[model samples]
Target: MKSTLYLLLQIFVLVIFRSDVFCQEAHKWGGQKDGTFSNPVLPADYSDLDAIRVGDDFYAISSTMQFSPGMVILHSKDLVNWEIAGHVVNDLTKVSPNLDWSSMNSYGRGIWAGSIRYYKNKFWVYFASPDDGFFMSSATDPKGPWEPLHKVWDVSGWDDCCSFCDDDGQLYFIATNFKLDPNNNKKYNIHLFKMSQDGKTLLPNTDSIIHQSPGSEANKLYKINGLYYHFFSEVKAEGRVMMMERSQNIHGPWEIRQLNHVNKTVDREPNQGGLIQLKDGKWWFFTHHGSGDWEGRAASLLPVTWIDGWPMIGEVGKDGIGNMVWSAKAPIAVNKALKIQTDDDFSAVTLRPQWEWNYQPRSDKWSLSARKGFLRLMAFRPLKPDDTVRILLRAGNTITQRSMRTKFNIATVKIDISGMYNGQFAGLTHFSTKSYCMIGIKQDGEDRKLVYSSDSQNLIGVTITGSNVWLRSSWDYQGLNRYFYSLNGKDFLPFGNSTQLTWGSYRGDRVGIFNFNRFATKGYIDLDYFDYQYSKQ
Candidate 1:
């Protein structure tokens, strides 16, 4: 009897321990860990994210660079577990048919500082492309047919414009004008104007220079308890968030808050973000951190509290160390975790929502069918390998690691090079100036060859007419420096080491597949499938 009782106790203990482990893993993807905070909670490259709180719901939008589906819209309840609600821009061909990330025209250009607000039972989003101009779109529902883009103003170098609707129903637009005054040598200045009653255009004669801070960008205005607060970024060699308030009328005598300062991460220069008060009366600040390169800029969130009627962000205790809060539960839990499906079966007529084409994507460039479960990419004449116009996919999240696995042999993956205008081929690549790698098939007369190369600038390696090949690519935290190819999909062979490439004023690298067929022909390449997995590393 004693032996049986001891055995029963052991079984009970094991059952309890197993249940505990299961619960922990289920909560792993949701809640905050004990005493630990998740920095860059969003691992993907979500730069210049502006978050807005409406009731208990939180919505955010970020810069999409030249990607086809620009202006990604995200929703969160607890400020974690974000889901791609939808896209602001449906197609890029309507905007720019060709995108050049290397050219000065495309560098640091695209959607920036999107402002989301609820006004009179409608959702309004103000998005700006400094290279182009400012645009506004609205929808009654969060997910829907967002109204067509309405050009508000065509001022030169205008970026990061935000809108505020007063309690009296008067709408105002706040923004920074980059028109340089040759005499003063200053580039960016803040401006404000009241919108027409119809909301279709700006009200004339209401345009006025509200405030001008030298080198300041992304100016936003808010009203709280009869006080008008203006928030903006001071972009010196280093960047910092600056805030000022006024109790007087909208015209003048604004008092700059003495304690208004937010710390910038070593990577980012305090580019842009948003401030909101939670339903519980707690204040929170959301902003982006520059990753040294333009590509590395990712979004981060911190807590804020008002002390003596002024905002105190990232406050430090007596030890002079700032504490970032960690919450296991989201501010507002939804029906499901906010997520985007990354797994691809290559069996659909259209590309997955998680996939984005660099710059602009041709509508008929690629396709999928339910019968074959394979992705058929049409091949055409190749453009410059480094050009952003070539078909390229986007890499999201910085801290989350993604791995792609495929089993198809290289010989079976054939490319039809019949209609050649210039030169064209299909391959997998790490698309970034800082670093890149490609394993592709090149055409030689009627036969095809396999070529592997890296942009590290150290060495280039290619294997002509290689057979039975499986390729794998990855980008490490230090920058994309690792490359390994396989034949059986079990063991990988290290290729040539190379030097890193750098673009002007940008950081981070993107990994994806590319086909350099710019001639617009109908040739095609067969890909079995691509499996992408992400994990916190």
Candidate 2:
């Protein structure tokens, strides 16, 4: 009896400990055990990044063109591990009526490069849409319930904007203007404008030319040690490289220098990014390597050293430019492993912070509450009456998250087709602006068929007679992906040739869970779960 009681107590303790463990899916790219980390800190595509440190916390915003909950805001403590804090824009329809699902034309042109700053007890985010105009959103907290987006400027042809609040309470705005330069026949001039105290309007006639060069953009401003420094990127013969100009005065004669390294191919030309100063009086540069692939531009954290009052990125060589370092000691000491985003089980009362719709999702079209433990996506028809072929890319309510970098990775989703109607298609996809491939199920009248569709071809496989099916896409670091199907959710079979992922527009490739009607809006599919398993090979 004593022995049996002891065994029962041990079992009870084991059960209690297991119950307390957190078991949601998670992946850390440069995870290390010994208070050290490595490069591509975020293995996903977090491009055109602007980061700001507030007290002990760091906040960053990345460009998410045409994706709803636009301008993904990320938070970090050590600048290596990150989490999805919130989004700047909740409903992109507020930006433009054309962005609605009915129109579906704003694929490559919603929110572009933006700046995030903290001032006067609030966090401010300012960004531009090439088609709409310049906009701003703010919140008392970076993990935000941000204010409704405010249109600061109702003009176009401008991109990559930053906001500055000076010591004397003067407000200023700097951005790249994309007007045809009659002299150079290009539109890469950097311009500065005065902003109102309310942060609502750009003062008329306050525009002044700061720098003009071929492909000059991605501007950032800093005032340090009584010196005004302006940072931007200019297209070089090799690739886009960093450029900086400084003057004692905000407006005056500014001396400029080209900051670059000779290892052009390895570093992919360190160009557009921002700078941050740590509490320990150390500075670091956050940059995106310009050489893009199917996965998109990746972010890098570089050590910054100021020599003779000029900030040098990477390692200062004989040419005064910094060379890229593949591995370096982490700047700060918070060694926890965290990822910006991950997979979903659809078990929460609200959508996971990592998932965002392709556009402002139609409320009536998708639901998480209707199905207690699943995401239900209702098929919607094309926005235009003349669009005879319903394109999967244009479908509203397509849920997506950034695809991370690993030697090998696989994304799988289990979808239920019981509610599917004729002409409805639901699947898992690898998506970008220029190309996309879907591995899913299509309904035709009473028959259900497995199908694989790419940019150039759409092929149908054998009929699947089941209420639920699992679809998957697997790829490697080289961006070659193949589709597969599993009827039992355990046994899987490959379906198609490998498709090379490609970058499109200003964004990288993303994995999406989508449902759409090819003929009419009459069906739906329930996604039981999404699983992402990956590791460096």
| Backbone clash count, each prediction separately | 24, 0
**Per-residue lDDT for 1-537 in model 2, tens only?**
999999999988765653311110123345456665556676667888899899998888988887887898888888877889888888888888777776777777988898988887889889988877899988998767898889998888889999998889888999988877568576777889999997889999999998989888889988999889999988877678788899988885899987666334445666778889999999988777666656677777878889888888887889787777655678887546556557789999878788878877888988889889999999877554344233766677789988876768899999988999998888988888778888888899999999888878879898989899999889876678999999999999999778988778767889888888868879999989999987731
User: Candidate 1: misplaced stretches above 4 Å?
Assistant: 1-31, 96-105, 236-238, 258-267, 316-336, 339-341, 369-372, 382-423, 433-435, 456-469, 487-491, 498-507, 518-522
User: What TM-score quantifies how close candidate 1 is to the native fold?
Assistant: 0.78
For model 2, state the Cα shift of residue 147 in Å. 0.7
TM-score of 2: 0.90
Best by TM-score: 2
| Count of backbone collisions within predicted model 2 | 0
Give candidate 1's whole-model lDDT: 0.57
| Deviation from native of the Cα of residue 475 in model 2, angstroms | 1.1
Tens digit of lDDT per residue, candidate 1, span 1-537?
Answer: 999999999988866754422211211233354433344555446677788888778888877766656777777777755777767777644444444322213535666666878888888888777766777888887666788877777655787788888889999888888776878676776778899765657888887776776666756778887888877766444345444556556655677653233334332443467787888887777766543342355555666767656665555455432333323234444334555456566677655666665555444555566227766565543334345332232211101111211111121122232332234456565555344556665554455555665542323344434434555554433233445666555776666553242223242455566565444454455566565544431
Q: Pull out the clashing pairs in model 2.
A: none
